[model samples]
Each structure stands twice: as C-alpha cells, then as structure tokens.
Target: MTVKPADRDFDALFADPSTRARAARGVSIRLSGLTRRFGELEVLRGIDLDIAAGRFVAIVGRSGCGKSTLLRLLSGLDRPSGGELAFGAGEDDDVVPRLMFQEPRLLPWARVVDNVAVGLGRDRDAPDGRLRVASALAAVGLAEKAEAWPAVLSGGQKQRVALARALVSRPRFLALDEPLGALDALTRIGMQSLLERVWLAQGFTAVLVTHDVGEAIALADRVVMIEEGRVALDVAVDLPRPRRRGSAEAARLEAEILRHLVHEEPPDVGWVI
Candidate 1:
C-alpha cells in the first residue's frame, strides 16, 4: 500500500517493531478552558477534557448544544476563542486530522477511487497514489466499486466510499459528525460495525458526535454529554466490544445517558455521580 504523504511519520512508526509499540499508545488530547463564540453567542464555554490516545470517545447532545462546534475546533477546522488544545507524545504535535460529515460529500464527476484520493490533496498525483487509494477502498469493502461513479452507488456504498476517503489520509485523529445518520436502520448497524473494526485495526483516536445515545454507548470507550455549551456529564462505558444491543447492561447505560439529555436538570443530582 502507498503511504499517505501526510501520514508517513505515523505509518513509519507502525512499520518498525520498536516504534509499533509506541504507536499503539494513541495520542493524548488535552483541552483547557476551551471556548468558542459567534458575536454575542457562546457555543463552547470554558470546557476542559482529556482523551487518552487510541481511545474512542463519543460526544452526544441535543441540537444546538455546541457539540458540533467543539468538534470543529478539535479538528482544527475552527479556531477556539480561548483555551489550550494540545496533542501529546508525537514528533509532530499537530497531525492533520480527518473529518467526516453526515453527507458522503463525494464529487459526482469523480470516480469512487478518485473521490477517495481527494483526501490525499496534492499527493493524489504522487506515484503511489493509486496503491493508497486501492488499499483504502479495500479496507472499506468498496474495492469492487472503486471504478464506479458515485451516483451509481447506493447510499451505504457512498458512505463507505466516504469512509475510505476519510481513512485514505491515514489520519491519527478521526472526527465523525453523524456520518451514518442518513442510512437506513440495517445499513446504519452495518456501518457501525465497519467503523468499530476499522478503529480497532488503526488504533486512531476517534471523536464522534452523534445524538443517538444507543450508538454512542455501543461504540465508545467513554461517552460525554454536552449540555448548554458545557460538559454536563462524562461517563465511562465499561461494556465489552461487539455488545449486544438489547442487553440489560446496554439498556441501563443508554438510560443513564438519556436521562441527562432528556431532563432540564439532572434528576436527583447527587445520585448521578
């Protein structure tokens, strides 16, 4: 597979056995007093959080709760008004992060491979670009559709291509903004499995923003609830991977998260700790 130009350092770390151990220790994210505002409105307010490297974190909230804004800042797509955002333990502290949105955002005129290649930016024309694109497509189970047009593929296929595009860059940080929200129920479940598999294989630090409490509990090592521009609750999900959706433990955790989103104020506040 061709190494993504931007991810050469990260990829190199994995290629060497000595560095591979270090690479598996995911990067740490530190945010202190993080704040963001638009005119008179504040979207994020004095937020502080720490994410262990290679861990999956899911942020959930109602609409307009500033979760998306926080994600934009984490992805470096938006600047924070105040606070420190730092990545720990890397030669280059700032790895180019990849962001996936609800829409596949594929170019209609570009073939599937080409669309995925776009993630490589100027590196798309590099000699190893084809190999890189092919590998990413195969990773997402879209190798058969690599040559097909985006318009010809189904919604799930397009999202798979989108995922391939997101992964093609070999990003150390993957920020997902409801990428699976548009899919059908069955497709959504399948994509969730695909996401978990890829995450486990790549060991990248993942931050997903979704309103689905169940989905958050199912995929995250920890679930953070954002309320009124602040972190209302941060809870660890101790459930094992490949969790049974209908399991009692899953249902209980889902209820715990839902309580925060549904209540104006936390119910029996002292009891929730």
Candidate 2:
C-alpha cells in the first residue's frame, strides 16, 4: 500500500524514541577503538570519542586527517572499518541523518523549488511536499527564487538552495562536510550567518567539519580539534550570539586551537617547574 501523502511528518522522525536518543540530552556519539584503512594506508586510527546531543560542534584538522570520513560515518553515508558506530536514537526508529556537502549539487535542469522537493521524496504533488518545499526556500531567503533555474542563481544562492534541500527533511542530526568551503570570503561569511539563523530556528544535532578556525568558533557551541586521526582538544565556547571574527574572545579561542593545530604544543612557554 502507498503511504498517505499526509502521513510523513519530517518532524515526527525526530519525535521517535530512537531518534530522540540520538539528539536529546545525555546522549553521545561513542566510537571505541575505531579504525579505517584503504588498501595499506590507515585514514582513521583507533578512535574513541563521544559528542553530546543538541550541541553544535566543529571538527578541524589539516588535509588527510579523516575529518570528512568521521562526519560521513556519523551520517551513515559510510560505515566504520573496525569500531562500533551506534547512535542513541532508539531500537525502533532509524537515525534521521542528513549530509550537506561543499558543493551545492543542485540539478541544473530542475527549478530551484523542485530541487528542494527532491528531499521530500518522489511525489511533488502532495500538500505537505509543497508546504515543506516552500517553507524551506523561505527559510533560506529564496522563496522568490523558487521558479528560477540553477544556472540563473549566484554561487551563494545555489549553496543556499542545497541547504534548503537538506533542511526540508527535518533531519535529527546534520553532518556538514565543509559546506561553505567553495565560496568566496564575503559570501562565506554571509553563509555562516545564514546557517546560524537556520540552526537557531530549528535546533538539530549538528556536527560540522571545517578548515576555517574562525568559522568554526563563530558557529559551533563546541570545537574539537583532530590530529593523527584522533581528537586532540575539545573546547566549549561560552559566548553570545552573532559571534564576530577578530573579537577579543574569538581571537583568544582561535589562538588556543591554532597552538595545538599548527605548532603541536600548548601555551606552556610561561609554565614554571
């Protein structure tokens, strides 16, 4: 039997007990002795970590640190090679996960509205589908661009469209794979604000993988630094909204993370025996 057009509430997916476990309070993403290998090279080593639910966290590392691979594992886009990957969602409800990539990946031949509706499943005629698609576009400030094709929109707009597609699903957990890496500096900053706005309205469990230290601190509630395929430092940001780069606090936190990330040392020059 075909499911009723009105039956699926994208929000309901998170309401499930299992889904709640994945994003609700007291839950964590635990990886024990996790490792991944491609041929003879190990990308991720014996990894063990936990991420609290409903917290915005950023993972950063130099190239080949397997940061993207970690996000993919959380999103279920890929499985772990040698560790248990369990989400706290529940036994009954599947983990409602979504991934946003660096590229917009919108269909050039499809209308902007239709591209978002693709996440709503195959049927475009349902009322819920229409409502979801319209609301998503509006959320990204592109309600008026619904009729436009991908080729007509600017780079930022296309990326916004891609974000809308991800939002339409009301995912319980969001895995971001450097979603703004491709945009120019100014545009990237704008997108950062736009992302925060969406997250504020619709609070979801988010794990962002980014190379930009400023961007990570500006957007994440917690920032985790990964090195040698393992998390090195996990710092929490207790600051106000609309965090601006070059702010006193931002500068301090950036310096702290960078000291570990680049110099491979902590602030110990002043330490005394």
Candidate 3:
C-alpha cells in the first residue's frame, strides 16, 4: 500500500515518544471588568470572566448581545476598551490564540496542505512544517484531501480544512465564532462532535460563541448567557461527554436557556449548576 504524505506525517508525529507530551497545555484566561465600545455603542460592559485551563465554555445569547465581541477580545483580535485581559502563566508567551469563524476563509489557489501550512506563519518553511500540517489534516479526518484545492471540497470539508489550519500550530486558546452555523443541520451536528473530540484530544481552552442553545448544552463544560452587553447567566453543563442530543436533560437545559433569552432575565430554576 502506498503511504500518502499525510499518512507518513501522521505516523511521524506519533513515532516520536515526545510527541505525546508535546501537546500544548491550555491557557487560563482572566477578564477583569472587560469593556468594548464602538464610538458610543457599548458592546461589552464591565464583563468579568475567568476560564480555567482546558475548559470548554460556550457563550450563547440573542443577536447583538456582544458575544462575538467578547470572543474577539479573548482571541486577541480586538482590544478591550477598558480593564484587563490576561492569560495564565507557565505557557510560551509566543503562542498566539487561534480563531475560527463561520466562513472557512481558505485560499482558493492553495492546496489543502498549503492552506493549513498558513497557520505556521513565519515557520512555514521549517523542516517539519509539512509534518505538522499533515498531522493536523489527519486529526480532522481530511488526510486524503491534502492535495485537493479548497474550491473542490464540500462546505463541511472546507470547514475541516480551516479547523486543521487552526490546529496545526497547537494554539493554547481557540475562539470559535459560530463556526458550524453555516452548515446544514446534519453536517452541523457532525462538526460539533468533531469539535468536541479534537478539543478533548488537544486540551485547548475553547470559547465558542453560538446561538444554538442545544449546541451549547451538548458541547460546553459550561454555558454562559450574555444579555444586554452583560453576562446574565453562567451555568455549568455538568453532563457527561458524547451527550445524547435529544435526551430529556438536554431538552430541559435547552428550554431553560431559551427562556432566559426570550425573557431577558435569568431563569430562577437553579439552572446554574
């Protein structure tokens, strides 16, 4: 059997004993009185949140609730208008956070492997860059498409390539801005599972901004609801992994979050586990 480049790279990554221990540890995030404003339009107001290392937290809310703004701040794509945002100690300061959006944003002219290699930035020419890119493609189950063009891939496949690009550098923090919102319902669910699986394997601090309450409940370690530019509710998921989509517990949590979104008030049912 012919071993493809991706297969070879994937094997090489695991062949090294140090590779198992080389996964970057997730970073702890602290947001103290974080604020953001566009001229007079205040988006995030006096927000304070602390995410423990390796925690998967989902932010959900109605439109214009500043969830995306908060995500951008966390990813360092945008600066806080006031207050402080800090990452925890003990990790390499040079490792920047990665962000994925609803759009794949792949380069049309580039092959899948090359697009993924874009994540390496200045290190794209490093001797092991090809190995890193191929490993990431395998991680996202797209090893076979390594030489394909982005234009030829399906929507889900494009997103997978985008995800591989984000993962290639082993970022300590990842901010997702409704990345699966553009996919079909079935595809979205599959991508969600892929996301959870990769997150568990990579141990990156993940902050997902999504409007789907069920998605938040199903994937997040905790669910935070933002309302009127502030955090209205912070609830722990406290559910086992590989959660059943339509289970009674999932339905209940979904309804509770929806109720809060509709009423613009926190649910009084002790939903904050």
Clashes of each: 1, 3, 0
Work out the TM-score per prediction: 0.87, 0.84, 0.87
lDDT of 1: 0.83
* lDDT values, one for every candidate: 0.83, 0.77, 0.83
Query: What TM-score would you give candidate 3 relative to the actual structure?
Result: 0.87
* Candidate 3 lDDT score at position 11: 43
- Per-candidate Cα RMSD to the true structure, in Å, reads 6.3, 8.0, 5.4
lDDT of 3 by residue, 45-97 (tens): 98889988778999998778899999998887899899888897644456589
Assess the local accuracy of residue 85 in candidate 2 as a C-alpha lDDT between 0 and 100.
Answer: 71
Error of 3 at 237 (Å): 0.3
lDDT of 1 at 42: 93
RMSD of 3: 5.4
Which pairs of residues collide in candidate 2?
18-89, 18-90, 22-89
